[model samples]
Target: MSEDAGRVPAEPPDLRVGHEERAAAMRALDTHFEAGRLDVTEYGERSGVAGTATHRHELEELFTDLPAPHPEFSPAAGPPAVPEKAPDRHPLGHRHTAMALLPLLAVIGIVLLVVVGGQPAGLAFFPIVFLLAGRFGPRRF
Candidate 1:
């Protein structure tokens, strides 16, 4: 194994930046300008420098006198966390239960519609139940 295998990689001060970083720095400068921390002329100067900055350190230097709301830089450290696996489920799960219940619910709804014999709006209940079941059913993947 390499000697540095166990160490978190250091973020070099002179790391080259891209357009995204420069834009972020400009946004920070705009915020300071709006908060009255920097006058129009100072804002213009700092924004110019930010627009032309080539390295992470150059951007960091722009915020030396400012407070929070700095541009976020990704750390050169450890690997990203692995996602947890989905839980195991039974062969007959929530989706199966829902599928079995839907027809039964429709039958009950039809019976109510026939017995009550008012508005046929009661038939809408079946579709609503079907939608709810599908939405809240267990994951297939």
Candidate 2:
């Protein structure tokens, strides 16, 4: 009582009890996936990111019936609980200004040099101008 009463547990089994609790959470997740509440892609994705295989395996059991106490539990709680989340991420997708413009820039340069037969002395200068603009373009806030 003299020391801080609310200190983290400092023993191995107590630490393991935390793991057990996480396993319980995994079992809950398994329940969510089994009810068709979660799809294969989502189940796999979430399981892949899980901290332990025991958690991931329980997740698979959601798809296949494996006997357990209470088997799984679903809560009124929002989306299936993911103990971990994907790191800050952007979809690996194309931007219209990207795919649409890069090819055009190349095409125009090609046209000026090949189709136009390189007659214009200024044709070479255009690429340099575009390069400068791309390099130092103002970032729109």
Candidate 3:
């Protein structure tokens, strides 16, 4: 027996394409035509070939001179890499720091209330909390 008898045949690189693949190639050809890369006559010719293409290489040949938006035949490298977020400078952010100071601000306000001899001037300090909250609050889109 020959050594080749034990080995299985490898799949062909130019695999047969399906309707979806042909349609996608046609779409890519449409994009090139719209971009002015292919004139009306060339566009019609390439599109016709794309429609009738039975193998992946035949579709690939249609885009040989074109840029991206080509039909993918090879397997993807891997899942996309997620970007790493930067570390926070302060773990307890500005909002938390502002909240932490609320009790101290209230004490200062009360002292002002007592020393100001019943004048409502101490009420001014309470608005600082609101200003801090507005400045440090979670941002809306």
Question: Which should have the higher lDDT, number 1 or number 2?
Answer: 1
For each candidate, what TM-score against the reference?
0.48, 0.24, 0.43
lDDT of 2 at 120: 64
Candidate 3 residue 109 Cα shift, in angstroms, is 99
What lDDT does the true structure give each of the candidates? 0.80, 0.52, 0.76
lDDT at 67, model 1: 95
Query: Which residue pairs in candidate 2 collide?
Result: none
TM-score of 2: 0.24
Model 3 TM-score relative to the real fold:
0.43
- Which stretches of model 2 miss by more than 4 angstroms? 1-17, 52-141
Candidate 2 per-residue lDDT, tens place, 66-107, comes to 343332323223455768876644363345345446645765
Candidate 1 global CA lDDT score:
0.80
Error of 3 at 21 (Å): 0.3
> In model 3, where is the ten-residue run with the lowest total lDDT?
71-80
Model 1 spans with C-alpha error above 4 angstroms: 1-7, 76-141
For residues 1-141, write the lDDT of model 1, one tens digit per residue.
998999976788998887888988988888988999999988988888889988899999989999998998766546669999877666657667776676567667776786787757776676776665676554477
- Clash pairs for candidate 3: none
The whole-model C-alpha lDDT of candidate 2 against the native structure comes to: 0.52
- The candidate maximizing TM-score is 1
> Candidate 3 local accuracy as lDDT?
0.76
